[model samples]
Target: MLRFALFVLFGSVFAGCASIQPYYTPNPDIAANEVEDYEGPLDAELVAGTNIAQRIARREAADYAFIGSAAFTGAADEDWTSAMVRLGRTLKTEKIDYFTWYAGTDTATGMTSVPVMRTSFGTVWGPDGPRTVPVTMLDTDWLPYSYTVPRYEYRVLYYKKRKEPLPMGIRYEWPGEELGRRIGTRKALEITLVVPGRTGWKNDLFDGDVILAVNGRTPTKELMRQFCRAPAGGKLKIWRDGQIVEKTISADPSEGK
Candidate 1:
């Protein structure tokens, strides 16, 4: 609810004005994590009631989630086409996988118009010669006459989508260091076996544990070769026993200077 008023610039005169609420409002119902686009096609159905609660109940019974809803006042001047245009915009913007709409009749009361009068005096020449006359005029101002604004409230649209399945809680570790040959030092790799618990395997690798990076890289085949062939040592960041550890790698001894 708001009120408006106006004041004359550099003058003591002030005029009061009325502020009316808008006839339509857009109401959307959606959750942050529930947002997702439909894979196939989307559609809408215009239902014929205004009971939001009942509409919600029906949606729940059908295992649907709400997307959005809106109420429109069916003003005499607002035809079906215009109303549908607004509804279409809403439906498209909401992009709900499914839609249900409701419509009904109601009224709104408010000021429709305001009438103001203006007067002026002037001298005019007529058949009887020059004459002084006072002219009065009524200004057709549509700003302030208050009245009952009978607005027929109709159509309640419901938007919804299929309920999403709950995500599984299972978390599976990799179970083996299959890429160790490319991601680990050559000596460590030579002593290592991809299979768990190989006899005399000096290299260490546990389930879900592996060397992730070398010199801030993922240690791909090319990157590992470059790091190994370099003359200076580079840091090796490894994930072991639920923690990250750093080690230094010396230039490959076989790369004789």
Candidate 2:
């Protein structure tokens, strides 16, 4: 009888402890009304280390993925096919934390597509690395001037030896190697093209010398357009080693004149 009474008393004590005041409180940073904002368990979905592929996949589905239309030709160093392959490989590896949205390329023309999303998502990774969406573009009037923005976005416009290089911009790099940082700038396309001998690009007096200027203008896009109608083999002045070099064209060079 004594043991049974003791057991009953212990059970009563445990039950009473179980019903103690609800004393657990949230930290000051988290407001009571904001608890619903957390969708998943805490600390479960953060990206800790480098998972290049996973990051790309998540960004691919994000609304901030390349939006609208971006030029996707194979003329430059990075063409549509190459970009798609790279991006697809990135998506295949990364573990997705959330279903942000989707981005695609046009099947016909190979243009890159923009992100489609319902709710706002955060930083997403690309083949390059993690990136945040441009929050400013969400505003109403930011559309019209936007077209000019990407044109000047510096990229390495790498092209074939004979063709023009394309643009591929990077945000950060090692110190003192900041090249190809801008596209539409005045000197963005500055390059040294070697001219062949005795050809239209050769200097008149100095054999094998380059035919630098065309129609009294330097080798620039604006100048080329102005002299478009002029015939090839036209007289041009060039500067080499800070000296004025003159050349006589033997044949007409198209496009670039």
lDDT (C-alpha, whole model) for all candidates: 0.41, 0.29
Model 1 CA lDDT for position 164: 43
**Candidate 1 lDDT, 114-221, residue by residue in tens:** 567878898999999998888888877654343433355444343445334211100112223554434444222121112222211113333344556668775454
TM-score of 2: 0.23
Across 70-165, the per-residue lDDT of candidate 2 in tens digits comes to 122222222322332222222221112211111333222223444444445478889999987743323222222211111111111110011221
How many clashes show up in model 1? 16
Q: Which window of 10 residues has the lowest lDDT sum in candidate 2?
A: 165-174
Clashes of each: 16, 21
